[model samples]
Target chain A: MSALRIALFLILFSFALANENPDAHVFPRPLVIEYPENIEPRFDDEVRLKCASWRFAGEANNLNPWKTIPEECAGYVKDYMTGKGYESDLLRASEEAGVYAQNVELGGDGKDVWVFDVDETLISNLPYYYEHGFGLEVFDSVEFDKWVEKGVAPAIKSSLKLYQDIKRLGFKAFLLTGRSDRHREVTVENLKNAGFQDWDKLVLRLPEDHVKSATTYKSEKRSQMVEEGFRIVGNSGDQWSDLLGSSMSQRSFKLPNPMYFIP
Target chain B: MSALRIALFLILFSFALANENPDAHVFPRPLVIEYPENIEPRFDDEVRLKCASWRFAGEANNLNPWKTIPEECAGYVKDYMTGKGYESDLLRASEEAGVYAQNVELGGDGKDVWVFDVDETLISNLPYYYEHGFGLEVFDSVEFDKWVEKGVAPAIKSSLKLYQDIKRLGFKAFLLTGRSDRHREVTVENLKNAGFQDWDKLVLRLPEDHVKSATTYKSEKRSQMVEEGFRIVGNSGDQWSDLLGSSMSQRSFKLPNPMYFIP
Candidate 1:
C-alpha cells in the first residue's frame, strides 16, 4: 500500500478502538438493583439508592480548576476520625503491644509521632484521577507537582481539619505518602495549600524503597519516629500497611479510600 | 483432693486457655504491613488492615450494634457511600462499574429497579465494631436488630439522603442482605425506626446458604428482578461477591469496608 494509505489505515484503526467505548476510561455500565422484598417485614429502616461510580477521566482529563472537595464528604471524614472512642483502642493496643509513649500527653519532645499517608489517607485524590483519566500508570511527579501547584486536588477537607484538630489537641503530625520524594516541593506546597499548616514532619515515599509495600514502608517510618524518641501515639492511612506492626503507635486510624489503593 | 481444691484447679486451667487469646476466631498471625517499603505496591490499593484473614468473623461483624463498634470509626460507614466523584475510588468504581442509575429521562416503566446490600453500603455499621472493641467472639444479629430498631445507628446519612433523592426522582428501591430471613419482621421495623419510610422490598439470605459466598444467593435473587423487567441499575455491597456476575444488574457499587470483608 502507498505510505499515505498506510497512515490513513492506522488512523482508522485507532478511531475504531476509541469509539468501541465512547466514555474512554470512564465506564458507564448501568447499576443493578436486586435486593429481595421481605417475606416477613419487621423493622423500620432507611435504605439508600446510591451511585457507586463517578466520572473520572484520570489526571489527564480533569479540566475543571481544582477546588475544595465536596462538603458532604468533608464532614463525613472529619466526623469519622474525631468522633468514636477509637483512642481507647489505641491506648489498649499500645498497652498490649508496649507501643505507647511514656508520656500520655502530645508534643512532649515529639519523641513519638504519628505518620500518615497523604493521598488516600489524609486527602482525597480521586478528583485528580478522574479529571485527568490517569489510571494504572506510574505517577508523573512533574504532572503531579503541576496539579498540586494548581491547587486542584483539595485535602480531604475533613481529614485536614481533623489533623489540625489533632494538632491543636497535642498530637504531632507527620505525613508519609507513596508519592515520590522528587515531588516533595509540590507535595509540601499542596499540603500547605490544603490547610495543613503545622506538621511535625512530612515523609514522602522514597522511590527506591517506600513505594514497595506502602504498609511496610509506612511501618518502617514509624521506627524513625520512634528513634526520634516520640512514641507514635497513632498512625493513620487509607491502607493497613501504614499502621501494621508499629510498636509505638498502638492505635491505627484509617480513613476511607474509594479511589486508589496499594493493596 | 478436696472438692474446693478441684474447683480452683479447674478455674485456673480455664483461665489460662481463655487468656491465651480471647479471639479464637481470628486467623493466625497478622497481615503484611510495611514490607520493606520498596516492594511493588499492590496497585489495587483498598486492601484492609485485616485483608488476608477475612473469615466468619469479618463477614458477620457488621451485624453487631453500632455502639459496640469503635467510636473513631462512627462516620466511616456513612462516609463510604455518600462520597462520590473523584474523591473516592470505591465510589468511583461503583460509578465506573455502571451501577449508578442515570438518565432518568430514559426511564419508562416503573418496573425497572435495582437491589442493594445494607451494612457498609447504605448504613454505616463501623461504629458498632469499633465501639465493641473488635469483639471477634461476638456475632449478634439480634442486638443489631435491636440497635437498628432503636434507630440509634446513624445512616450513611449522605447515602440516606441520596436514597431519598433517588426515590423522589422515581426509582423503586429494594434491599437484599445476609441478615437471616427469620428476622424479616424485625428488619422491616428497624428500617422504619431508622427513618426509611418507603423501603419497597427486603430479601434476607438463607441461614444455610450464608456460609460460603452470600453473593451467590444474591445473584440467584436477581432472577426475580429480571422477571419483572427491571433493569437493575446497580448493585451495592461491601463484598465483591454481592455484585458478581448478575445479568439483571449491569454494574456493582462497592462501599469501603474497613472493619471486615468476606473475600
Candidate 2:
C-alpha cells in the first residue's frame, strides 16, 4: 500500500473505533454483542461521569448495598468488566500483592498464610454475570448457587499467577470464601479444574455461619485461624467486606469488581 | 454548512481529538500545556494500565508509603489530577455524603458532629501540587508550609458544598487536619477566604501530636470527641489515615486525592 493510502486507512479505522467508544482507549474492548438498532445506549458525558463515580465510591466503600448497577451504568459496567481497564486493574493489584508477598520474611513454621476470596478474586463468575445483565439485575443466590453447581467458572489468570507466586514464597494459601459447606465438593472440583491446587485449606461457611454478615463471618473465621496459629500475612478480595474487620491480614489487596457489591 | 461539509468537519475534529487523548471521553480534559520537544510521553497500553492499577491499589489502601509517583506514571498522574475524572470522582463521593446526611437522624443537642480533613478534603492544594509535578516530587514539609502560609489554597467546590449541606442537616462540621498548630492562623484565614465558616472547631496538631502518626493523632482526637459527648456521625478525608482506626464515624466518605498520599 502507498504511504498516503495507508494513512487514509488508519484514519477511517480510528474513526469507526472512536464512534463505538466515546472514551476510546488504546486497549479496545470488544463489544459483547452489538446493540440492536437504535436501542444502543448513547453514553454522553454525564452518564459516564455518574457511572464512573458510583464505581469509585463502591471501591472505596462509600457506596454500599446497591441492589443492582445503576440503570445508566449498565452499558458502562459492561464495557469496563470486559475491557483492558478491568484486566489491568486486576493485574495491578496482583502485581502489588506479589511484590509485598516477596518482601515479607515468613516464619518457617508453615503457619503463615495468605487468604484469597474465591468468586471474582480468583475464578471470575463473569459468564454468570453476563447471562444476568452485568450487574443490572438484582442478585439471586439460589440461581447463582445453581450456576456454582455447574462448577465451570474460569480462572482469573493474573490472580491465579499471584496465588501461585505467593504460595511459592512460603506462604500457606487459604481459600476463604462465603460459599457454604454444601458446595464444598463442587467448589474444590471447580478450583482444581481452574488450576488452583495445594491450597492449605479451603474455608467455607458452616451452617451456623450464614446468619452473620460477610465481614463478621470472615473475621470470626480468621480469628479461628489465628487461634490455630495461622498468621494471615496477605489478603486479597474483590469486596471490602472480605478484607475488613478484626483479625485481618498484614496487607490487603482489593481486586476490581464493578459487577456487584457483596455488602 | 451543507450536510456533507458538516460531516467532513466532524471527522476532522474527532481525528484531532483522538490523536490527543487515546481514551478520548466525551468529558474532555483541557491540556495544561503543550509538551516541548521530544519529551511528550507516549502513554502506551502498558503505562496506562500500570499507573491506573497503582491508583486502584492506593485508593484501596493496598499500596502505601511511597515517596513519589513512579517516574513512568508522572504524566498519568498529571492527567488524572487535572482531568474531569478526578472532579467527577469527588462529586460522586460528595453526592453520596449529602444523601446519607439527609437521612441521618441527628440529635438536636449540637453534639452530632461530622469530621472533615482539611487539605485535599475541604481546601485543595492543587496549585501547590501542580507546581511540584503532581506528587512526582518527594513531599517537603518546609516548602509545603510555605504554601499553606500564603493561605490562598482554593476550596474543593464539591466538598465545601457538602460541608454546608450536611451542616444544614444538623451535623456540626469539625475540621480535623494533620497540619501543626503553627499554621492555624493562616489555615483559618485560608478556610474563611475559601468560603468556609461556622465550623464547630478547627483541630490541628499539637506539640505532643508532632510525634504521633496521622492515624494515631486523629484516632486519639476522635476518641476525645466521643468522651466530650460529641457523636461523630460522619467523617471525610482524602487519606486513608484520616478514616482508618478506632472511633471513626457512623459513616466515612473518601474524596479522591491522587495528587498525594498523606501517609
Candidate 3:
C-alpha cells in the first residue's frame, strides 16, 4: 500500500510539472482589464455619428482611401469574430444552405456550379487584422500582400464544412476571388492548407480584364460560367458585389464581413 | 465694394461662432488614440484558441455568467449595427420582400399577414446599449425594463420603411414580442411613440404559457395564428426563434443583433 501511494504521488507531480512548463506555451498571460477611469474614451459622439453616416452612405458612394475604419467600430468587429451571435448566424446560414442544396434536384450534367468567395467567407484575415489594430490604421496593400503570401489564413469552419457538404451533394465548388491572378499560386496553396480540397475551379482577376468595379468583373465571370452551360445553383460571398448583378445564382448566401467595404 | 467685403466678413464670423456654440452640440469631443504600447496583448494564441472553442461549444452549453464579451467581438457587433454591410443587407432584403409581395396576387381578404418582432427588429434599443457598455457589462433586467418604460427606443430606419411599405401593399402587420403580457400597454405606447402605426395585433407571452424554451412558446403562438385563417407571407426578427418552428411564414428576414442571445 505504501509503495502504491508513492507511485501515485510521483505520477501526479509529473503531470503538474508538465502543465507548468513554459516551453510548452500552453498558458497565455491573463487579459489586462483597464478600468474606464484609467482610459479615455476611444470614441466621441461625433465620431460615432460619422461612423454611422459612413455606413449608411458607403453603399451608394464607393469608399475612398482617405477614409479609415473608426476606432470605435473595433468593438463591433470583435463581437462578430469572437462572439456567439456571429457564430450562431453563420451556422444558421450554412445549415440553411446545406438544406437548400439537398432539396434541389441536380441534373448531374457536371455543370452544376456553386460559387464561393475567398476572404472572410471561406477563410479569415482575422489574424492579420488582430495584429494590425483591427483596421484602426490605414490599409496598406504591400503589408496585406505579404500576409497573403504567407498562406496561413485559417478556414472559416462553418463555410469549409458547407463546401464539403455541397460537394458531397453533387455540386461543383468554384472559388471566385477578387484577388489578382498574380497571387494565384499562393492563394491555391493557402486554400489547400486551410482544409479546402478538390475544388472544381479557382477564379481570380486577370491583368487584361480591367473592369470598372468588382461587381462588373465578378458578374462577367459568372456570366461566362453560365454561357459554358454551368448552372450556378448556389453562390456565397461576404460582399454584395459577389451576389448581385447578371447571371446570379438561384440562391445566394452572404457571410458577414464588416472590416472593409468593397465596391 | 469695401462695404460689401466688410459685410461678408461679419457674416462668416457669425457663422463660425454659431458652429462653435456649445448649446448647438454639433461638435463632439475628439477620440483619444491609445497606442498599442499602452495595451498589453489581451489576445494570445491560447486566448484565441479558447475564444474559438467557446464559440463552437457555447450553443450546446450555456455560457457562464462570468464570461464577458471579448474585445475582438466588438467589431462584429459594430459592423452589424453601424457598418454599411448590415444596412445594405437589410435594404436588399426589404427590396426583395417588396418585389415578392408585389408579384403575389392578393385576394383582398385581409387574411395575408406580415409578422415583425418588436425589439431590435422594429424598435432599436441602441440608445440604451450605447449608454451602457454595449453588452460588455452583464445584462440587468431591472435596468433594461426601466429603459424600456422610458418609451424612447427609436425605430430601426430600414425596418420602419419596410413596415410602411408592406402595410401600403395590403399585408396586415402583426407585432410579436417575447416581452410579458403585463407590459403590453407600455409596449403599445412605446411603439406608437416610435412611429409604428396600425399594427393589427401585438402578441406577448402570458404567465401561464411559460414553456421550456422560447422557441416552443413562440412556435405555438404562430401555429395558433395560422389556424385563425391568416396566411403569414412575411415574418422578420433578429432571433432565429422568431423564424423557426411550425407554421413559418413564406418568407423570413433577420435583422442583425449581436448584443444578446435569447434562448
Candidate 4:
C-alpha cells in the first residue's frame, strides 16, 4: 500500500511537471484608443478631406480604365442574382430598361411596383475609380459629374441580383438613386449597360426639399410606392440610408458590403 | 546601434537556449476527439459517450451563466433592436415571445409581423443541460418535458435584451423554432416569465417533417408572412434558420450563438 501511494504521488508529480508551461513568449494585449473628452469643431480642410475620400477622390478611375469586369465578381453577381430568382431577358429592349416585375397583392387589390436607391446605393463607379487609384487627393465635382454623365459605373452585382429577383417575383424593379436629378440620363444608360430593363421610375434626389430627409431617402420612396397603390414587398440596399425612411414597407433587406459607406 | 543589435541577438539566443527543452517534457497536443462528426451515423449510446467527454465536459464552472428578463442583457439588446427600428408592441411581443426583431417596418395595412427561431436562436437551454452532469442519459422525454415545463433555465441576457428591444419596436413578433410543436406551451411560458408579451406565432418543427433542406422552412415562413399580407420589416435570431427564410423581406438580422446548431 505504501509503495502504491509513492507510485501514485510520483505519477501525479510527473503529470504536473509534464503539464507545466516552459519559457514562452507572451503576446502583448492590443491597445485601445479612447474618444476625446471634448468635441471639436470641423474645419474646412477636414471637410474637404472627408468629401474627397468619400466622393470625389478617384475621378479619373471613374472614367473606366479596366477593359473588362473581374471574372470572380461577375460570377458572384450572376450566381447571386440567379439565386434570388432573376430570369434572363433575352429581348434587348426589355433588358435596357432595368425593369422586372413581381406579383404583389395588398388588401385584395393587386398593383405593380418598383424600388431603388442612390449614391453607392445605386450605381457605383467607385470600383472603377478604386482600381485606378484615382481621387485620393482632390475633390473634383467636375470630374465626378462627368463620370455620372457618362453613366459608366455598373450596378453592384449583388444589388443587381436582388433587382432581378424582385422582377422574377413579378413586380417592376425601379431605379431610385441619390444621384441629382440632372444625372438621370447617364444613370439610366449605366443601368442599361449593366443588364437592367424596364425601370418604370428613375426617382432622383431632388435638388430641393420635396422630401423630408435626403439621408433617409427610402422612407420617401415608400410613400411613393403607397401612393401608387403598389404593395412594396421587398426593399434592398447596401446602407441603412436606403431603409431608414421606408418605415411602411413590407420588408427591407441589406446586402453585404466590405468596401464603402454612404456617409 | 551596433551594440544594441548585438545585445538583441544575444537576448534572442539566450531565449532560444532556455527553451531548448532538454527534458523534452513538451506536453502532447490535447486529444481532439471528433465527436461532432461522430454524433451523426453512430448509435445513440456512442453519441452519448462522445458527448460526455466532449469539450462541453468538465468546464461547467467557467461557463458564466446569465439571465435576460432577470436583467443582464438589456443594454446590448436595446441598442441593437432600437437601431434596427423595432419600436412598439411588435418589439414588446417579441420580448414576450422570447426572440429578437430587427429592421421592422409597418405594413400599409395593420398586419403586424415578425419572425424568430428555436434552439439557441431563441432560448439557450443547452448550458443548463450540458452544464450539470446531465447528459443524454437524463434526456428522456419525461425529464426533458419536465424541464421544458419549468421554462426557467435562466434566460441568456443578450437574447433577452434583444427580445425586449424587439417588443419595444411595436410589431408582433413570432417564434419559429426547430423544436417539436409539442414543446410550444413550455416555450411560450418560459418566454412570458422572462417578461415578453407579444408572441404572434411559434412555428415549431413537426415531428414527422423536420425542415431538412437549407432553404425550405424559412421559405415557407416568409411565404406565410407574404400570404398573410404581413410586411415583415425585420427578422432576427441566432441561427441562420431564422433570417434565411425572409430572403425577400425588407430586412434580415442575425445574432451570435455559441451553443447549438441544426446542420
Candidate 5:
C-alpha cells in the first residue's frame, strides 16, 4: 500500500477501537459481575445488618451469613476496584493528604512516617476475587496465599500514585500488613514487582506474635512505631481496623472497600 | 463630570473593589476572624484531643480544655461558613446525594425522608458565633437561646441549595434538631425567614424526652421518624451525633463545624 493509504487505514483502525470501548481508558472492566443473584434488597436494613455483623463480628464457620452478596455490595466492590468514580475519589483523598503532609513541618529525624496497608490497598487482589466469586464463597486461605505468592497482583493505580507523591513529600513510608511472616519474602517480592519501591520498613505478623485481632495487632504495631519516635502523619487503609484503635495516625484515609470484611 | 470620564471612574472603582476582595461572590466575609489570636498550634494533637473529648464526652464546666482553639479548627469553621473550598465540597456532596435520591424508587407512601440538622447544617449560627467568640469562651445557653428567639439566623447557602435539590428530587425533608422544643416556634420562623419552605416535619427535643446524651436523643428521634413509615435516604449534620446511633439513613454527610463542640 502507498504511505498515504497506510496512514489512512491506521487512523480508521484507531477510530474503530475507540468506538468499541469509549470508557476503556477511564474505567477498566469491573472485576466482578455487575449483578449477583440471591442477594436482593440491596442497601436495605437487612443488608446493612449483615454487613455490620460481618464487619464487627467475624464470619461464622468460614461462611458469610448471606447466601449471596447484594447487588449494591457487588457494585461497591466493582466501583472501587475498577470504576472512574473510585479513581477520582482516591485522587481527591490523596490530594488532600498531600496538602496535610506538606503542611506539617517534619523534624527530619527519620521519624516522619506514613503507614500503608498491603492487600486490596497498594496492590489489589481483584483478579483473585474475580475468579473466586467475589466473597460469596468462604475465604480459602491456602488459595489466597498461593495467589499472593504469584507476586503479580496489579497496583491500585491511584494508591500507587499517592505512594509516590507522599514519598516525594519526604514521608518515611511504612508498610504494615496483616499478612503472616511466612509470606514476607513473597510479599516483598510482590510489592517490588507491583511498582512499590524503597519503603522504609515492611512490618508483618510474626509466627509467634499471636494477637487478639487484626485491629489489636495493627494498633500495637503502630504504637510501637510511635514509641520509636516516629510521627505518623498519614495512614491509608481499606479496612477500618487498619486506621482505627490506639496510637492512631494524625490523619487516616479509608479507601473504598466492600468486598470482604476484615476484623 | 463628562459622561465618558464618569463611566471610566466607576469602572476603576469597581475594579478596586474586586481586587480588594475577589472571593466575595461565593464566600461572604467569614463570620470568624481569618486569624484568631492565641489559637496557635492549629492542627496539632492538642486540638485533636480536645475536639475528640468534646465530641465523645461532651463539655466540662462549660469550657473547652484548650485555652485557645487550633488555627485549623477556626479555619475549618471559617472555610465552611465562608470559603470557596467549602462551597465546592458541599456542592459535590449534594450532587452525590442527588444521584442517590434520584435513583431510589420511593414507595410514594409519604415515607421517603431526608433528615437535616438545624444549627450549622441548614441555617447557620455564624452570626451568633461571630459575636460570641466562636467557642473560645464558655457557651452561654441563655444568650444562644435569645439568639435563636431572634429568628434570624441565615441559611447555610450550600445546605439550602441541597435542601432545595433534594426536595426537587422528591425526598421529604425533615428538620430534626437538638434544639429544645421551646424554640420550635422561633425555629420555624427562622427557617421560613431564612428561605426554607414546605419541610415535612420539624422535630425538637421536648422537655419530657430527657435522654442521657444528645446521641441518644437524636437517635431516638430518628428511630421515631422511621416508625412513622419514613425511609430516610439521606441524613446530614454538623455533629456526628446527628448521623450516628440507630436507624441511620442510607447515607450521611457531615458539614464541617469546628467552632463549637456539640454532643
Candidate 6:
C-alpha cells in the first residue's frame, strides 16, 4: 500500500480509538490520493498544477458532458470545494451578478426575471458530494435523489445573498432546476429552509423532458418564458447547460462547481 | 511604498547590482500587488483564493470586455502565466483538443478544417505581456504594434504540437485571427518561425472590419469558411469570442487566458 493509504489508515484508527465515527465521510476521504500513472510522486506540485489546469479547462466548457472529476483532480476539487477557494469563487460570481443586476434597467412591468439553478448554485451539494469521493466516483442519481428528498442541504451563502439582492432590485427570481417533478415538494422545502423565499417560479423537469439535454431543455423553457413576454436579465447556474443556447439571459452567471458537470 | 513595492524594488536593485538588466520585464513585473483595497495582507490565503476565483470567473466568460487583471490578482496572474500553471493549462487544453481531433471522422473530401486563433492561441505573447504588467495594465495597441512588427513571438509549445497533430490527422488548418491585414506579413513570418507551416488559409481582419467585435468578426469569417464548403471540425482559441456565436465548429476548445480579455 502507498504511504498515503497508510497515513489515512492510521488517521482512521486514531478516530476509532477515540470511539468516534470511522466512516470515510467522518474523516476526509482519501480522494485521488494515488498519483496519476505518469507522474512521479515527488512531483506533487505538478499534480496540483495539472488539477488546476483541468479545472480551468472544465470551466472553459472544454470538458463538456464530463461525468465526474478526474482522479487526478479529486483532491484538488475537495480542497477547493471545502476551503476558501469555493467560497470566494461563489462570492465573486454573485458579486458580479449583483453588480450586473444593479445596472440593468428593469422594465417596470415586472417582466424581468433572473434564473437560478437550484443545485450547487443556490444550495450547497457539498454535504452529498462530500460523501461521494468529491466527484472521483461517477455520479449516482439514485443516491442523489435520496439526498434531495432529505431536504437538508444548506444554502450556498453567496447565492442566497444574490437571490435576495436581485429580488430586492425588482427582478423576479425563477428557480429552474433539473430535479424531476416528483421531488418538487422536498426541493421546495429544502430551498425555503435554506433561506430562499418568494421565488416567482420553481420549474422542475417533466417526465417528457428526460430525454432532452439540459441545454436544450433549459433553452426551450426560457424560450417559453420569452414567448410569455418575460425578459430574462440574468441567469446563474453551476452548469453551462443552464446558461447557454437560444433565449439565454442578457447576462449569464456561472458559479464554480468543479465536482460534477451535468451536460 | 507598500512592502511588496519595496521588495520588488530591492529585487530589481539586486539585479542591477550584478550589472543585469533592470528592465521590468527582465525582472518579473509586480502585477496586482495591491490587496484590492479590502483584504488584510495577513490573510494571504484569502487573497490567493479570491484571485483563483477571479481567474475561474474570467474563464467562464463572466468578465467580458475586461481591460486588466484585478489589482488583487496581478501577482497571481503573473505567477500563473509564468509558472507551471500556465504550462499545464496549455497542456490540458491541447491534450483535450488532440483527443477530440483524433476521434472526428474525416469527410475524406479534404474539407475538414480546424480553426486556430493566432495571438496567445497558436503563439506565445508572454514576451510582450511580461513587459506589460502581465495584463495588470490596460492593453496598449501602439506598444503591441511595435512588438508585432518585431516578429519574435514564439510558439505556444503544446498548441504547436496539436496544430501538427490535427494537420497530420487529415484536417486542414485555418489560421483565423483578429490581427489586422497590415500585420499579416510579420504575423506570417512569426508563425512560420514559431514552427507553424502548411496552413490552408491565414484569415486576418480587414480595415473595414476594424470596428467589429472579435466574436462578430470571427463568426463572419467562419461563416464565410462554411460558405466556401470547408467543414470546421474544431475551433481553438484563448478567447470566448474566438469560440462562440454562429457557425462555430463541431467542437470548440478554449485555452486558458486570464491575462487579458477580448470582447
The chain A TM-scores for the candidates, taken one by one, are 0.54, 0.85, 0.75, 0.51, 0.73, 0.83
Docking quality of model 4: it rates as incorrect
lDDT of 4 at B85: 17
State the TM-score of the second chain for every model.
0.57, 0.85, 0.72, 0.51, 0.72, 0.84
TM-score, every prediction: 0.36, 0.83, 0.46, 0.38, 0.47, 0.83
- Better candidate by DockQ, 2 or 5: 2
Give the clash count for model 6.
1
TM-score of chain A of 1: 0.54
User: How well is each residue in B1-263 modelled by candidate 2, as lDDT tens digits?
Assistant: 35754453344334323443323432222223233435565587678877877887788777846888888998888787766788788878888888888888888899999999999998777767877998989999899987788676666777778988987788888999999998899899878876788998899999999999899999999999999999999999989889988887878888887767765
**Segments of candidate 2 deviating more than 4 angstroms:** A1-42, B1-42
Q: Alpha carbon lDDT of residue B114, candidate 5?
A: 92
Candidate 5 per-residue lDDT over residues A66-162, each given as its tens digit: 3344544554444334545444444445555566677788877778999999987787777677776676667888999877776556566667777
lDDT of prediction 5:
0.64
Candidate 1 regions off by >4 Å? Answer: A1-263, B1-105, B134-152
Q: On lDDT, who's better, 2 or 5? A: 2
Q: Which is the winner by TM-score between candidate 4 and candidate 5? A: 5
| Candidate 1 positional error at A135, Å | 7.9
Interface RMSD of each: 12.9, 1.6, 12.5, 24.6, 17.0, 1.4
lDDT of 2 by residue, A64-155 (tens): 46779888898888777766778778877888888888888889999999999999998878767877998988899999997788766666
Q: Which candidate has the top score in TM-score?
A: 2
Q: Model 5: residues >4 Å from true position, as ranges?
A: A1-263, B1-27, B30-68, B71-81
Q: State the interface C-alpha RMSD of candidate 6.
A: 1.4
Q: What's the true lDDT of residue A54 in model 5? A: 31
lDDT of each: 0.47, 0.80, 0.65, 0.43, 0.64, 0.79
Give the fraction of true interface contacts kept by model 2. Answer: 0.63
CA RMSD for every model?
Answer: 23.4, 12.2, 17.2, 24.8, 17.5, 10.4
- Report the C-alpha lDDT of model 3 over A1-263, residue by residue, as the tens digit: 65753453344223323343323321111112122333444566555444533432332221332235657766544544444444454554566677778888998698898999999888777667766655667778899998787666666667877999989999999899998899999889778766789999999999966564788888999999999999999988877678767788877776645567666
Candidate 6: segments with Cα more than 4 A from true spot = A1-43, B1-43
